[model samples]
Target: MATVRLLTMLPLWWSLCVSSALTPVRLRTLPLWWSLYISNALTPQALLAEWQAARIKSLDVDASRYHAQVLFVDDDNARARMAESCADALAHWADAGWWIYPHSCSLTEDQALIENPRQEAILTSLGFDGTRVTAAGAALAKEDLDAYDLVICADAAVRDAVLALGEESYETSVRLLADFATVADARSRALFDGLDVALAERARSRQDGGELVVEGADAQSDRDGFDALLESTLVLTAALVVFLKDSFDASFTDSFNGLLRTHFYDERHVDARWADAEPALRRHIVTGALDPRERERLFDAHMTGLRQRLSGDGVSS
Candidate 1:
């Protein structure tokens, strides 16, 4: 009887071993659980393997990303499509990211990519899992510009427009984006249009305020700033997607090395080129302020904080 019982247990052990290998699991967590079972053998090892796999899978689905919002300033329907494609490809991931495309970011109403079935399907396939899809652009209440680490522009037209908007107009644009939050009507398209109008007005203000002032030689600077803001914004926004997908776990930092590069800050791009000439452009950002001196001081404080951080990173002074 004793010999027969021992022999039967051999099959039970073999079954457990096979099950552990067959189940889908993360590469890292598998070993620890496998070892526990291999050593303890008190409970089923396969169950432990399954649990670890589930935990890791959850990380991919949720992570807190910063500045995942992207503002794509486009000009026409074709441009919107192109921008959407690029935004989808860049933003679509395990953790959904945003590419806030405002129709008014373009030149006219028809310029927006409002309806595209195939593109939507493609984005869906990529897991564009964003919870909200607002047609209105982001309304950042209060110039609260410092809250965002990056701002991306799809075109030079966008930068010119942003600079053109007056302070009140810019504030209204952000409000319009907020309006989308409450839009529960069939006329979502119309509500979205209202938001576009706000953005268009803001762009016009940026230009009229002399914020977008330029000459023959400095024309490239405007383009550079626009591009830089976009790339930096994409990177920042994508980082947020990555972070949120991982549920804000600091250990999920494996993605940074692949993207943290100089191409984003290089003058070959719009951001880099514009940053190189910030002294001249700085005035434009504070154009509507009551006290330019105080604003400049505040801006300086912000710059100091950024510069100190950059210096610590071994970046060139």
Candidate 2:
């Protein structure tokens, strides 16, 4: 009798597993019986494997596919590493058919693979493989610029270097990474428009407001400066992902944005605050009054609210 009952529940159990894998929130809120069954029948590694497999299968079926190559160029390669690492973590760019290449405009051939310990640590903490970071063999050449579907520069200086290679055609394909965030929407534009002022204020507070230096005199100060830079890079890369995903499929942008938002902000209560007091939050963002930590928190909240609103419109994350 017990064997027969177990056999009868197998189909239902499989269905639940599939459903939970596709929508991970369901796994968290499973009933007592389901939870017990999962614990007894599957190890943690096995469950994770199941979930990953399900996710891959679902992604395979997505009609809105992307197949593009992207190159990230920067002076020391730190920005390029952060851009690729953050994009991989937040957007699953590899699975989405994005080929991301990182290059350094200043490093020589011998120094191409040298890693920045601080930047590597940050990427590793964010669940990316720091070993994967690499610099191009040579400086930014016209041939290199022409190879990629899009060439993203860390700043105006890097952009100018690529432009100096004397190819008018490079103008259309190459762009500043921050430009994506600024033009993404009203909120993003407002936040980024004030970013320079905010960064300047931060530098002045540290008593080193010249040339936007990220290094400091001491170890702790150095870490703090790098942390601020990393946060800025991650957020900017996220904005670029938003723009690309929206362009991939205008019809499903809401769903894609919801998924992106959940990756950035997972707190339900925080999402509620943004939904409740958007105008007040927008004011702070526009004025650059919020410090780096505060700015990240509010931005996460606002993006999370965007997810909720889109989900309410029948789009699932």
Best by lDDT: 2
lDDT of 2 at 96: 35
Model 2 misplacement above 4 A: 1-65, 93-114, 134-138, 184-221, 250-317
TM-scores of the models, in the order given: 0.24, 0.44
Instruction: Give per-residue CA lDDT, model 1, range 194-286, as digits (tens).
Output: 222443244333323312211111113344443322222223233323333333333223222112231233323322332443454444422
Worst 10 residues of 2 by lDDT: 1-10
Model 1 local distance difference test score:
0.33
Please provide, for model 2 over 1-317, each residue's C-alpha lDDT reduced to its tens digit, 9 standing for 90 to 100. 00001112134677566456545465568887887676655643344335433432232112233434667777665666666665555455323334233333432344344447655654565556555543333455567766666777776666677778746556667666654433333332232322234542442332222222221122234666575565555555655555555444442433333434544454343344434544444442222322445444545655666678768877664
In angstroms, give how far residue 17 of model 1 lies from its true place. 70
